[model samples]
Every structure is written in structure tokens, then in C-alpha cells.
Target: MNEQIVITFGNEKILTELKAAHPDRDLMMYQALSQPGEFMLLDHSGKDSVFKAPVFYDILSHSGEDKWDGFISFSTLDLNFDQQKVFDARINKLRTNGLPDGMHSIYSLNYHKDISQRIILGTWDDYADFELWKNSSDEFIPKEYRDSPNFYSHEAYYTPAKTKKTQ
Candidate 1:
């Protein structure tokens, strides 16, 4: 199945290097509003597209598969000491055990300025799937963290299509 992956860079220099190295793959870059020098490179083709780029292997701290033609959610949080440990442990469990039902993949990232801060980006096959996990009675995500102070939360639903370039 077609897959999507996001790889974040510490700064524009690294992103420029990646662009110079891999001209074949479609690499779309976005700057983070909250943190200067932070950038996110989105590759919707598949994991193989990312694996082929040597630069990705060098600087990527977090990378994961996303829904091919569904939706994506991104969030950033600043947690206390206890919350940080719990959050880390939960992320480790998810990574080791695999994603919860209806989820494609989730990535947990550390802020460049503050290591204690975290940013989570998740992709789901559909809106229903995303909601299922959020409102799950099983408590896939602990209640405390869910209600934590979220700095930002963004969601996008998209369908991939091919378009010819016009000169």
C-alpha cells in the first residue's frame, strides 16, 4: 500500500542538504511556527522513498508511516517531570507493541529548545478511526495526558492525486 512519512530536521541547513542530495523524491518542507530553525519534511510516496535518501538516516530523530489517503493529526505539549516519564513510557510501549487499532503510525518528537517538551504526530486511515482512539473506552491514551496543556493541535484530511506540471 502507498504510505506517507514525515522527517523533521533541526534546521534549514540540513533540509537544504537533503534537497540537494535527493532531487528525485518529492520533498515538501514546512517551517515550525513555534520554534525557529525547526522544519518538517513530508514525503507521501512511501517509506522506501525516505529510506533511499542517505541524508534522512543521518539527521532524523523521529520518523513513521502515515495514512496513504486519510488524515493526520499533530500536537505539541509541555509536560511536567512526572508527565514526561509517563509520556515517554507510553510512547515506548506503542512503538514496541505497534499502534493501537485504526492508527497507522505515531511519532513522538522532542523540542530543540526544551528537551522536556514533546510533539506528537499521528496518522489515521479515516476520521472515524482517529476519533475511535481518542474516545476509546479502553483508554489507549491516558486521560491525564489527553487533557494536558496542548500548545498546538492540527488535523488535515486529504486525498492524493496526480497532476501534470504546466509551464
Candidate 2:
């Protein structure tokens, strides 16, 4: 069976809170490699839990086609309009242009069971590739729309945290 996972992003205090609140849950935590106090926590068997913190947390599903790890990029986008077309176009471009150098795979996911909310999870060997991809901008979505109030994005990057739970 596939693992049902939920990912959470927050600071040290929130991480501690999560651990304390869900001690029995199988979790893997990642710390931001360059940014202190930032972390990403994954609950591998988290289908039943509802984490209601101000910090970001969402159910994650993947295509199950690629192996992903090392540097990670998690971007959450809140779109005012349906984004299926935009997402499809971006994936097609990646297939045509090939992934950025040192980047392994990228997955687009639905956020918190909301269709209008989307997440982009990217795995890379270096952070530069992520920066490049983010700055490259999507041609399918016009700059004005992306910059307007209709679109909002929050992103963070991390590496595996040194912890027994993660191991």
C-alpha cells in the first residue's frame, strides 16, 4: 500500500509541539539547510490526524514514479482560478525542456483537500537549480496574474534533519 503522508512547516517551537502532540505517529523531519529555525515534518502514516496550527500543514499525494530526496522545495500556492491548465502546461514544458541541472524530480500536489490550493514539491541536489526554476517564471501564466491578488505563494527549502525519527 502507498504511504499516506502529511507535511508540516514551522519553526523549532512548532516542531516540538508537533512531536509532543503526536508522539506515536511515524514522522520524518527536515531542517532548512541554510535557514536556521525552519523545518519540514512529514507524517508517513498521517491519514487520520488533523493538525490545526497556524503553521502550514497539508496532505500530500504523489505520482509514485520518481525517487526524490536531498534538497527539497515546498511551495504552496493559493489560486483564485482553476489551475489545471497552467499546471499541465508547466509539466509539459519540463518534459520537453528537461529538468533543471542537479534537479531530480518535481511533483505538483493538491493542498489540504482543496482543489484551488496547490503545492509544488521539488527534489534537488543543489539549491541553485530551485532558485533558477523559481525565477524562470511560467509562460503559461501571465506575469500580471501571477503578481496580482489572485495568486499567493509561500515557499521554503530544506534538507534532512539529523534525528532518529528521520532515520
Instruction: Estimate the TM-score of every prediction.
Output: 0.53, 0.65
104-157 per-residue lDDT for model 2 (tens digits): 766666655576767777778768867776778564345765778757777877
**Ten-residue segment with the worst summed lDDT in candidate 2?**
59-68
- Cα lDDT of all candidates, in order? 0.55, 0.64
The number of the candidate with the highest TM-score is: 2
For model 1, which pairs clash?
none
For model 2, which pairs clash? none
Give one digit per residue, the lDDT tens place, for model 1 in 64-161: 56554445556555677777777777777667777767777776755434556566666667667777777764333566556656533343333222
